[model samples]
Target: MGKYTQDAQQLLRLIGGKENIAAVSHCVTRMRFVLNDPSKADVEAIEAMKVVKGSFTQAGQFQVIIGNAVADFYNDFVKVAGVEGVSKDAVKQAAKKNQNVLQKVIAALAEIFAPLIPAIMAAFVLVYLERFFRKISPQVISSVVVPFCSLVLAVMAAHFIVGPIGWKIGSAISSVVYAGITGSFKVVFGAIFGFVYAPLVITGLHHMSNAIDLQLIADYGGTMLWPMIALSNIAQGSAVMGMIILQKKNVAAQEVNVPAGISCYLGVTEPAIFGVNLKYGFPFICGMIGSAISAVVCVMTSTTANAVGVGGIPGILSIQPKYMGSFAICMVIAFVIPMTLTFIVGKKKLSMADRVGAGDSADTVDVSAEAGSISATENTETTELNGDGANTLRAFLTGKVIPLKEVNDGVFSEGVMGDGLAILPENDTLYAPCDGEVTVLMDESRHACGLTLENGMEILLHIGIDTVEMQGDGFEYLVSLNQKVKQGTPLVRFDREKIRTAGHPDVTVCIVTEEGNAKDFEFVTDIHAEAGKTEIVLFN
Candidate 1:
């Protein structure tokens, strides 16, 4: 018998046996079941099982968390019940059959809106502001005055004034978009609109489409605009797939690329757009070109959607049955062209460094000689320094050393800010590379620090890629700004797990932001080094 056979038999019996289960599947940590009659399952008994950690019902599926052993448990459960397990997608499809009309609508809406939670969280800023106001108010009137003022300000700013202005602007834009998609030169306009739609999503203007789509449905019984939006999403997803092909060897790139691409194809494009395409530049343009071509085809065939359904390949379900054939052709164009163009362009233009989702060009930092002033010289030169005459720089963190060009950040990799070497750090603490006075410390983020060595070589030690967004949460400063420190002094201690959890690389970079009278420097790279002991760079 399998290790989980007995437990699986008990679970299966508690969940109403195979007779009640319509479908079953397992994700990384949970067993998902779609039941023919959910009421037959005993939730309390299932939760009390030794292998079960917790249980809950969401959408239409009953999920039982089994920590890391869900797959084994699911297999045994299926075997004991004399039933075959299904894929997650199959489970989802079966689950939906159990829901009523309202439940189905709610589930669909939840799926559509789940991707927007990050953006919606911006409203929490008002909650934080309210707390601040309460803290500052006198204790006697704090409760009444603070709540009253906050309520009035929030209501006035959001409901009475800003809300109306925003609605009018959105409506005006939506009207223009509505007219363009339905006008005489619609094919031409469709090409332009499809190309720009993804960028509109970036700027939050795409929300205006919901109003336009509903209005069009009310007036004309359908809207052609939504078909193009759906095609655009497929195009972006295709572009991300192409990137995946180009970056197959890069594990980090694949982690973001695969899921983001899948999400995009499923009608949520934010992950692909912000996480990969926009970060790299070319894929986004490639996707846009493909979208433009597909949109032209959509308009030529006069394809229209009954309403905005899933904005992807599944979107065909929402198209008028008569136009499905033509929309299928448009879908083919959307899928094939962007992927082809992205692979071709990425192969020629993207380096190994670029495929890893390099940091934005805007991340360039300028470092200068003055304390607290950050600026880099545009005309810096590189020359080799002989080992005999060189001043050594100790390793800042124990890790595998790599050339700056290999770093997954355009600003540091391309040497736009300064030439540097990066390390895939093995530890969380940063130590002084040499005896120097701290010249620059990022007050807000604390992800980077600058120092002027005793011999005047200005070095910038950056902790990780895009870690500035953490806002000093996982970082603790060991030495203050402008403090003179000897070699090997602990400079900054960071939480590497926190950095990784926040979706950023923990590569530490040591850059020569300014040469400071040193005519030449040599970088020692590719080998693992010990922090504060091994020499990684030399200056002369």
Candidate 2:
């Protein structure tokens, strides 16, 4: 199944072919398919495929999991099935459509405002325009177009798009949360928030709770929220430290640990949240559980902070000496519990690349440079292999292709005919590009030779720029017209320096005469192209 065609063929056959596929999209790991009838899929066969990692029914779709080479498999699947694809982000959005009533309401609010985004943007632009026009008229500014257009748009946007909807949602959540925190169930709310807050920091929405803490300080002179913030931070920091201890040799993890620790201890948890804890799923949960326990203790002991700052060591400094013992105990509990839990239950040792998620790249260098037509500085000829383990074309020979820019002839340089490789002769030798029949040969001039590859890709080798003008001097052709030649079989030999002395550039250009199929090849004019060696492009 490493063969893309075979993989596609098998996947289609096992899943009841193209007729059963309702929709399909691919992420980094899986080919997500919404099937007409998922029951028709041969789950066992799919898992058994060499390229397939596994298969699953997830989010109301049949998902075929592939590992790092999912992209290659997905492309083949599309070609074999001829189905249009949605993006990974779209797949995620589609998955989110299956939601509960409360989630639907919240999603609906966001969706409602989504269409008004353009109007909101207009309001901002209008304000800028108003400010720009204001300086031109001190008196007319009162009755100016700026005020009517900009300010009105801003007001309308705030009222309809943001103020009512956003304020109402915030107010509702605030009311419920405030009641929970201030009522007899303060301990429950404290624990719940402590367990959830670090996760919220991953989405960068923990700032919302900062407003609650500030309000608590303003109204009741203390916040049940502040204790959780401190506990959560310390716990998160300890969890990262534990991860570092576990995978001491993981450079990426170690690189993140120190900075993330500093950020968490300083009350800015973003670095720790995103860089460390959030990346490792279990470490974060361990931190949360430890945080929950510390939060419960803080709530029971009535620990408080007098001011607003990051609620770790900084917040503790603001606390009175009477509650110092409670704060110290909270810190110790938060740090110790997460450290223990993470060390015990967290993930196994990870590589540095895996720790930082550098292993997953969205836009990889899988495709060849699209410049057989124009390779920035030169022309490159590329042939792609489909990973079928039965490649049609191997390297004809190993040599570098010079950029077409170096070619002096206008017709060859501009690629008016077609795109291909240009090689500067190092040893004044030529070879067949593929298994082909030598259809045309200028045996006398020895400047160029033409062949028809087995796959019908026509090849024209121009030995040097404007070498045809030299007639047959310093050129020697080894093959005759209609002669059969294998790839890498030397076809021409000429004095490269003789052509240079004759005032012609020693750049040899290979062009395809049939059609502009040169675009299909990888244009690697910059790199040295080695015949029978370098694999420049891969395709069907």
Candidate 3:
């Protein structure tokens, strides 16, 4: 997948002018274009263009497949269309508009946590791997446990990753009150100062509570550390709340309704934070408060020792019974207070009803403003027969089968997307075996493509197991835009990285007719099993 700057003018011209687009949305790889009429789309023309992976219709949406380069293209599209990026002043105005302290806090949390999902998941898998090895053998557990234990430095990870982000948001807020103070580094130093002061305060409060023989903590054995955590979290959550408000007021118009509220409620914070905005510090504070308060309360109630680690929703789950109620209270308070406040403040500032999702609305935008005359290129390819005599036909789904690795070797316990049946690869450059038009190209460039052949047949070619993340690094495409490729002509060069990466035998090649109309036919080759010769699979 190449990064062609999406000329808003070119794209606008191709999609019958932007007025033709009833609405626009995007998935991992494709832009979902909703048109008032499908005929309004110059499907063949757009397909022939080199930049598009392909196009297809699914669930009433006309999808234009772009590769991993879609984001850059999208930004380019916005630029050509004269669309504006979210502005800082707009955000400041939004924050100053009408938010309470709690709302601001949650906004901060969302910003800090959203970008750190990858790192967080990496840490989580480390924990799971430790548990898995312990289950396998005692010796294995003893050998790897200490190293993994070191990775359980969750607080350190949070501080390093989230703390900086939170401070930046705080500084943005603080600038309104204190003149100057712009750099993230300066804000972070200030936050660190606050954080250091908190612990001492907690100790003092605990001792003061226990005037008789130092019973507040030493005798009564109370750990006030939880409140300190709660306080920190509240601060960050407020920031996140502020960001949401800002984004709502400032980001692109149109509402993206999604099933995010419940997800965020369950502590899946990244979606809302990343999906919404990041400039505010409040949401981050709220999130931190929620986690920290819960953590501290759990410690105080259960007297739990951190032989491993704590915090996060999972940590909240692992709390002992004595502290469970207190921790739950903290969790609820942490999420709800900030979210409610942010929503309310955002609504008031924007002078609009509460928005449910990030701005993914079904309203039409002038796509032509972005995509101009770029669609006028050639697209004459049709469902014509190649020398190989493989007529272009649609592939329909029969049933979802398991990948070879999923059934036996067990590298991955779960099955991947698409019907996981095995098919043979064509012998040569797998060209357009049928007379259909190229309809889609995947972002990963590894698998999942669509072609609408002549005679109303739709074909989907999904490449190997979990190969999407490869992002076009291995595979190479041979055909150019609007070029006629006969059946058995090589379309994509498949690399064997998927199999090699798993340390498995690479004897198998699959040609699965995994989508529309083509599943009516059966597999046509055992020639693929041949030793040392290039093998190809054909279907009728």
For TM-score, the strongest prediction is 1
How many clashes in each structure? 4, 18, 110
Question: Model 1, which residues run further than 4 Å from truth?
Answer: 1-179, 355-540
Candidate 2 per-residue C-alpha lDDT over 88-175 given as tens digits, one digit per residue, 9 for 90 to 100: 5565466554444654555445443433333445556567767766656567455666577667766776767755564555456556
- Measured with C-alpha atoms, the lDDT of residue 147 in candidate 2 is 75
- lDDT for 369 in candidate 3 is 16
Ranking by lDDT: 1, 2, 3
lDDT score of residue 276 within candidate 1: 72
TM-score of each: 0.38, 0.37, 0.26
lDDT leader: 1
Which sections of candidate 3 miss by over 4 Å?
Answer: 1-94, 97-420, 423-428, 443-449, 466-471, 481-484, 494-540
Q: Please, what's the RMSD in Å of model 2?
A: 22.0
| Each prediction's whole-model lDDT (CA) | 0.76, 0.63, 0.40
lDDT of 3 by residue, 425-492 (tens): 32322344344454444433434334454443444444444444455555555544334445544445
lDDT of 1: 0.76
